[model samples]
Target: MRVLIAGAHGQVGHELLRFAPDGCEVVALGSAELDITNAQQVAKVVERLRPQLIINAAAYTAVDKAESEPERAWAVNRDGIAHLAQTAERLGIPIFHISTDYVFAGDASEPYRETDPTGPTGVYGASKLGGELELVANCSEHIILRTSWVFGAHGNNFVKTMLRLGREREELGVVADQRGCPTSAASIARALWALAVQYREHGSLQWGLYHFSGTPACTWHEFALEIFRQAHALSLLERVPLVRAICTADYPTPATRPAWSVLDCAKLRETLGIAQADWREELAQVLRELA
Candidate 1:
């Protein structure tokens, strides 16, 4: 089966290229090669490739900056996805669109489920929600996977930022009030590849919105502490900095983050027989790679 992946240079996209199943033809394209916002280019490329499946990992993911640049966020997150979904539907190909956990209001006491009501608090979340709606409306053969707090060996992520800060400063403040699971891009890539292979073999899919994140939700403060712990163990850090736990009110940002953005992955597990990875294990691997 031929698989075309957009946003090939991103964390999850890069992992997808590395972990994709053998014997499958994979065409990975970064933004410079094929911008999803360009409708004509998307149509032309999809037509030329005629891939059996398309995985869209492209997104405008600057959460804080999105507050100041709503247009750019909407263009890539919503309109760009619309173009891909439309083109995929036209060519009778299935699409796997990556979404975020921000679509929820973060008010839920428990983990957010796939059927939860969406109330995005910021432009980034709203635009991603728009992208989800666009995909649902445009294509029937599409699976929208909503993940949270993604990190990996490649790209700019919270793990990398914390590592850099840990190396530079004596102390750092992390918001303890916010909570979510930290998913590994490698795990997400493997799961998506499994779904793609299943679809190709069976010629059918249980397509719809699903949630998949790492096991054991944690706050930014806790996550930072773990990073320091692992880095220190790996001898990657000369001096482990102090991570002070602070409330969300202590540090203000352009965008308001979800106070509780953990997602329940039971649906994906039940449907696809996929299990969530232990984030601590993944974190150790990531730290070792950095080391």
Candidate 2:
């Protein structure tokens, strides 16, 4: 099978490249090589490669910055995805695009389900939601995976940022009100590869949006404290600070984040027969690698 991965240099993309699945010829492309926002470039690449599967990991991920740069965010997140989906349709290929839990308004009492209505609080979320709509509309064979709080070995994720900051500061302030799962990019890559293989074997199955993340949910403060604790235990840090809890209003950003962005993984678990790893266990693996 021929698989073409966009944003191959990103956190999840890099991990996917490192953990390339068996029995597949993987062609990875970074933004410099193939700017997804350029429809002509996308069309040219897809036309030449004619890949059976296209897994898009490219995105404009600056959450707070997106508020001031909505156009830029939409270019890559919304319009870029439309281009990929359209090109996939032209080649009669399937696309596996990554999305986010920010599609929800963050007011849900429980985990957000696939069938729930989306009310994005910021431009970033709205752009991703736009991408989802485009993918569903433009292509019949596509998989939209909505995940949250993604972290791993590569990229500027919260896990890495906290590790760096914890070393310099005696105390840290993290937003405690916002609650969601910390999804490992490695796990997300594995799930994407699995879904790609399954789609190849069973083309008749339904193709649409699905939510996947770590099993247990946690606040940003709790997550930070856990990271510091594990880092200290592993000797990765000299001392772990008392990570103070703060509300969303305490530290304001240009983007309005959803208060709760936890996604329900019941459909993903049941349909794919996949189970999510615990958040701490996932974080431990990441830290071990960093160490």
Candidate 3:
């Protein structure tokens, strides 16, 4: 199978490249090589590579920044995806795209299912939702994986931020009211590969949207405490800083965060046999890599 991975330098994309299975010819490109926002570039690359599958790890992930730069965000998130979907549909190939939990309004009391109502409150989420609609509208053979609280050694994430703050400050405040799964890029890569393998073997997969994220949802403060705990155990941090539990109002950002971003992953587990990874275990592995 000839697989093409966009955003190859990103945390999840890096892992996807690292774990390229045997017998698969992988053509991985960073955003510099294949700018999805450029429709002509996308069509040209798809024609040149002619990959059997296109896995889009590329995205405009700056949540707060998207509020100020909606055009940039939409160009990359929505229009870029539309371009890819068009080319993929032209080639009759499938697309495995990564999405976010931010698509939800964050007001749900329970975990957000795939069928749950989507009401994005900010520009970033709205743009991502637009991308999702474009993909569905353009391509029939596609799989959308929505994840949350992503962290890895290869990119800027909550874990790295907390680790840096742990080393610099005696105390730090993290939003405790906002709860979501802290998924590792590694875990996401594994899940996507599993889907790819399933498709390769069966020649088709149950195509649609699914939620794949870390297990045991936690608040930002709790996640920060865990980060400090793991880093301290691994000797990555000489002194674990005090993590203060604060509400969303304590810290203001250009974008409004979901109060409850937990995604119900039972559909993926039951359908594709992909289970939620323990975020604590994944965090330990990331810490080890950083160390």
Candidate 4:
């Protein structure tokens, strides 16, 4: 099958290339190569490639910066996705789009299910939610995968930031109030590829929203401590600095992050017959890659 991956240079996109299923023709493109924001350019590429499946990994993911550049974020995330959905609908091709957990207001006590109401608190989250809605309205054969706390070797993720700060400073302060699962982009890529394969075989199956992430839930502070622990074990860090757990208010940003963005993966696990790996195991793999 022909698979086209947009934002091939991103964290998740890079992992998609690394972990994509074998025996499929994969074409990867970054923003420079195939600008999704430009409808004409997008149409041209889609027309030429004529891919059987399109995986949209491209997105404006500056959570804090989205507050200042809301237009750019909305253009790339929502408008671009709308274009992809419409084009895919026209060509009778399926689209697999990646979304985020920020869509929730983050006040829930338990894990957020697919049916949970989404009232995003930030421009980034709001734009992503808009894209999700557009896909459901415009495209019939579309799969939206909403994930959280994505980290990988290729991009500017929390793991990389923590490692950098842990090496530079004597102390690292991470928010303890914000709770979510740290999903490895490699895992997401693999799961997305599996779902794409399923869609290829059973085109008539229900194609809609699903939540995926690591098994265990953790706060940023805990995740940072784990990163330091693994880094120390791997001899990546010279000395383990004082990792402090602070509240969200202590490190205020322009965007309002969800206090609890944990997503329920029951439907994904049951429907795909897949088991999620523990966060520590996945973290080990990511750290190894970083090393």
- What is the C-alpha local distance difference test score of each model? 0.94, 0.91, 0.95, 0.90
Better of 1 and 2 by lDDT: 1
The residue-level lDDT of candidate 3 at 46 comes to 94
- Residue-level lDDT of model 1, residues 10-67, one tens digit each, is 9999999989898789999999989999999999999999999999999999999999
lDDT digits (tens) for residues 1-291 of candidate 3: 999999899989999987887788999999999999999999999999999999999999999999999999999999999999999999999999999999999998899999999999999999999999999999999999999999999989988888888889998889999999999999999999999999999999999999999999999989998889889998999988877899899899999999999999999999999999999999999999999
Taking all chains together, each candidate's TM-score versus the true structure is 0.99, 0.98, 0.99, 0.98
Every candidate's CA RMSD: 0.7, 1.0, 0.6, 1.0
Task: Please report, as a residue range, the 10-residue window in candidate 4 with the lowest summed lDDT.
Answer: 197-206
| lDDT at position 155, candidate 3 | 86
lDDT tens readout by residue for model 4, 187-262: 8998888887776677654678999999799999999999999999998899999998899999989998999989
> Model 3: residues >4 Å from true position, as ranges?
none
* Candidate 4 Cα misplacement greater than 4 A, ranges: none
Candidate 2, overall lDDT? 0.91
The 10 consecutive residues of candidate 1 with the worst lDDT sum are 282-291
Q: After aligning candidate 3 to the native by TM-score, how far in Å is the CA of 257 from where it should be? A: 0.3
Best by lDDT: 3
